[model samples]
Target: MGKALDNVYKHQSLAYKYFLYLISVALIVFFFPKGGKFKYEFQKGKPWQYENLYAPIDFSIKKSQEEIAQEQLSIRNSKTDYYTFDGSIVTTVKNDVQKGLEQWFATNTFTARQQRDALKIGMDVIDNIYSLGVFENHPGSNSIIVVRNNEAVPVAPSDFLDLESAKRRVSAELSHSAIENRIGLESVIQTSLRINLFYDEALTESALEQELSRISYTRGEVSQGRLIIAKGEVVEAENFKILNSLKEEYESELWRGNNYYYIILGYTILVALVLIMLFLFLKRYRNEIFKNNNKVTFIFFNILLMVLATTLMVKNNESYVYGVPLCILPLVLKNFFDARLGLFVHVLTVLILGFVVPNSFEYIFLQTIAGIVTILTASELYKRANLFISVGQITLIYIIGYFAFHAIHEGNLENIEWILFGVFVLNGLLTLFAQPLIYMFEKLFGLISDVSLLELSDTNSKLLKELSDKAPGTFHHSLQVANLAEAAANEIGANAMLVRVGALYHDVGKMEKPTFFTENQVTNVNPHDDLPPRESAKIIIDHVIQGIEIARRNNLPDRIIDFIRTHHGTTLVYYFYKKQQEMEAEVDENDFRYPGPIPFSKETAILMMSDAVEAASKSLKNPTFLVIDEFVEKIVKGQMQANQFLNANITLKEIEMVKKVLKQKLTNIYHLRVEYPE
Candidate 1:
């Protein structure tokens, strides 16, 4: 009945898993921009691979973006207008002339003849004033000019005068020039005249901008069937401009028709192919990851996260797309898995983004090179300096790539966008914070990383510190095992850091009753002498079980807790079982054996061997290099003959290498040698 229920559930689970995959892939592809890539990708200096390129539709050949921008600037600078003010103050000066004539009669300061002359000159100066507005030297103009009802009116530099100039001009132009200069009639005319014209700056700006909008953008026409370029022809600046115009017009018209749905379908298939390849890779090389639904979900979740963020940026504008942290994907992946997996996922992500972003060729080339560099440099980021160095290299790679692509498009650095260099700098600075992001993923995804291992390996950590205080002897033994395992793992090309950390915490179960284990029994008295062999074996076997419990309570990662449960295989406690065999004719061997699931990886298996060898090496009374070597060989050989490593994913040659590393380390710890005199 149980088997039948499990079979039914297994079929249902498979259907459910595949259903979720379909939904995830479908949702992502649905939101993708509906378009297909051109049949060929070409560069400015590169030769065209396809047959003669012809314009299929009647489209105008657009000017280069740089050329368009410069033309726009020229138009704005050319039509800039100046402020104009009409001479309405001339009418007020006429009224003031009557007041001045009356005031001259009342004051009696000037003679009747002088008053008549001053009034006549002041009246003439006010009437002769032209409707002119004066301004300082303006840019892109020989003289200050103002727009009047859509016509430009130029003002000579000396046309409108200052108070001193106005006084001198009014006095000099008088009918009695000699008598007017002596009488000083300049003050009377200067006071009556005023600056009636004023410059209106804001109004002029609006008129200039309106004039700039009238310029046309198209350079020329490319009628249908016109050959733009032939096969094997180098795409020069003019050819590139026409090709881009064709590409833009083609995309704009194609996406509006029913065929776009089919384009979406093609994109869906392509994206699905990449994701399915990643899944199959995990199933083959890292089946443990494939089996865990949570891990599979986390990997897909990151891809979705990057895709969503990148799409949002691209949707807003192409310039803002640079701010999206592309390297964060590979940095996060490399922290959790190996470099190959990181690079694989990064390439898939960039390929999908290529369809959404502008300039597909440059985007793909830049991101691919950056992803490769990130994978190669991002190792051992536990040290803070390594993180800085890696981020620096990734940022440098992005800057260099942008320069190379820019040079290809413009044929020189003449049209380089310095803002893009700034954008790459911003991208690099954002990448430096990936260390904190790795910590965030650990909390959010329930994942463990080497950064976590380095933290757990600290002797000052709570668990390790407690072990040292309570079970000094066992603590010492665990330390020696860690040293041996680390060296062995390094020799055999396994995760040396993981095995070392595992060895340190593997014996933490002995902390529950430190005095019961022989390593912690400082007094010569044995605690197990009071109990039966079976009961003593039960206590010994309980450590592996209890160790797992302790590790879990401490919130250590499951990857670490696994080492505690698998260090001891289902093997007998030899000394206690042998003593029972001497007293009883039939001693049940199972009662004296450890309840065990053997090590399941190279690092775990190395830990088991290191633990046994380090503990046994303490029993040699007169240890020499030869004795230690033979002793190490005997213990490792015994475990192999008993099939303790049946499940560990390691080979005979690797085990021999591990054995050699163990002997070398143990001999150094115990074997005595004469010190050389300095």
Candidate 2:
């Protein structure tokens, strides 16, 4: 049992123990309504080869979305409503009648009773006419006939003359009365009244919408045991409509029962299969990532986060499905892993999402194409321009995919949903924000990306600046090592940016005791000569420990600090040990060796090789091309002979390439032209 466990986990840590727990959570999240998968498949405008089908129950026929929209349009075109009444307008007319009558009677020397009679006649005139409410006249017509609660009332240009007719009627009816009173009544009626009606927009719209809600969506119905489509019959629009209607009603049938737990378990198994495959792939080919649960968690978490977003969008509405930024997943994952892994994970996620979305084929196809474009074009992610170009290409792919499928389904572009193109555009704009999001993931997941590595490579950074100030010689040495390692990494197709950053900060431990090292001493005085051999070696080896402390103090990523820990490895400090042995009868060799786990990756291994070669070349007696080339070869060969790079996944071919790069780079650094003319 112990042997089997050892093979599974080479070094058991607390992080590895939680692997099962995290996978459990991932399965729970992936669980959806998936226990019962439809057994049959059919496509519109295609021949059905399956056996004849019968309705399982009395499923009601549902209206297609287009049919529902047309019905609603018809109802809206015929709907009409009116405000019915306006009390404020009646008050205004009454006030106007009073003011006009009082002014007219003030000019006459009429008795008090005459004024009273005059006011009564004017008020009665306005009240009588305005009782019939006015309505908006239709354009290019004489007047409008408004239907108020099944009562038709005609309001015309003649209605404006009602007060005029009222004036003549009152004067004749009151002819027997005094002339002064009749004249006052006539003036008041003309001036006091005008149209006192307006269209009520808010309430009128409410009433019309209330009426619109009554339009029934069902134009027709399909009875139970109805023949939908027979075997080998082509599914045209008529049969397609009936099939869709049946599918809607069948899925929504609650009386048949649904086992929620069984459904969850089924989906969990499906997601587990895909994720376990990912784990096995990583554990076999990339165990470093597999053992580190944080990296695995980061990848799985990204997939889950994307799936959750998609599921939520579908739950809200299927039209929201296109608005989801599915392309953004591959674009982000490619930043940390290889393009193949990114594409694989994206395909799996889109496949799972297919069961949730309405138009599964188009949803998967457009997103899969977008993922491919993202992987192919999103190179040099540190350069903002590359990311921008990749986003534009991804959006263009989505638009073309949408257009092609739209034309295929509708048989023409006439019914194309132009808004879906806008959705793709929005998705591209969201993808451009990935630069900032990279930083967030790095912090949250404790992982680094190429974009962060670029920022770390700057020499003016805090730790690099301290190294330059305290130990200028060590600082210059780090720069040459960075350049050499970068070039070597490029030749081997390793992570060049990561190697360069690692090389720059590998010797930060030297900053703690700078004067003890030969390069930083820069004087006749040797600090190491004053101390015992064991003490001198101890100080030399302590740099790796001190560098790690300082790096962690400044919150450096664990990935970068890996270089400091492994650059020296467990090799002996031969110069000090040999000196101690010649002077003393006996010496303990372990005290003169640096404690290390050795280089464990291509980047760290390259750093180790570059550091040893660059530091040793400074001791050249008289520099020559042949001498420098031999010097580069000897140092790398010695490290290899000691099996220092045994754990790092590097090949002899890659090491030879590194040797060639170092030799050419060192030769150029000290290249001298012939002095024959002088």
Best by TM-score: 1
For candidate 1, give the lDDT of residue 146: 61
lDDT values of the candidates?
0.79, 0.77
Model 2 Cα lDDT, one tens digit per residue, 580-672: 998897898889888897999999999999999888888887878778878888898899888899999999999999999988888888874
Q: Which pairs, if any, clash in model 2?
A: none
Please provide TM-scores, in order, for all candidate models, with all chains considered together. Answer: 0.86, 0.84
**Cα RMSD for candidate 2?**
5.2
RMSD per prediction, one decimal? Answer: 4.2, 5.2
Task: Give the runs in model 2 whose Cα sits over 4 Å from its true position.
Answer: 1-49, 82-187, 192-210, 231-234, 254-256, 584-586, 622-626, 672-678
Please give, for residues 128-246, the per-residue lDDT of candidate 1 as tens digits: 65345223223344345665656777766557454455556666666455443433344555567665445566866676667667666788999999899999999887898889888
Off by over 4 Å in 1: 1-20, 23-36, 80-105, 108-117, 133-185, 188-202, 308-325, 357-362, 395-423, 574-595, 624-630, 641-643, 672-678
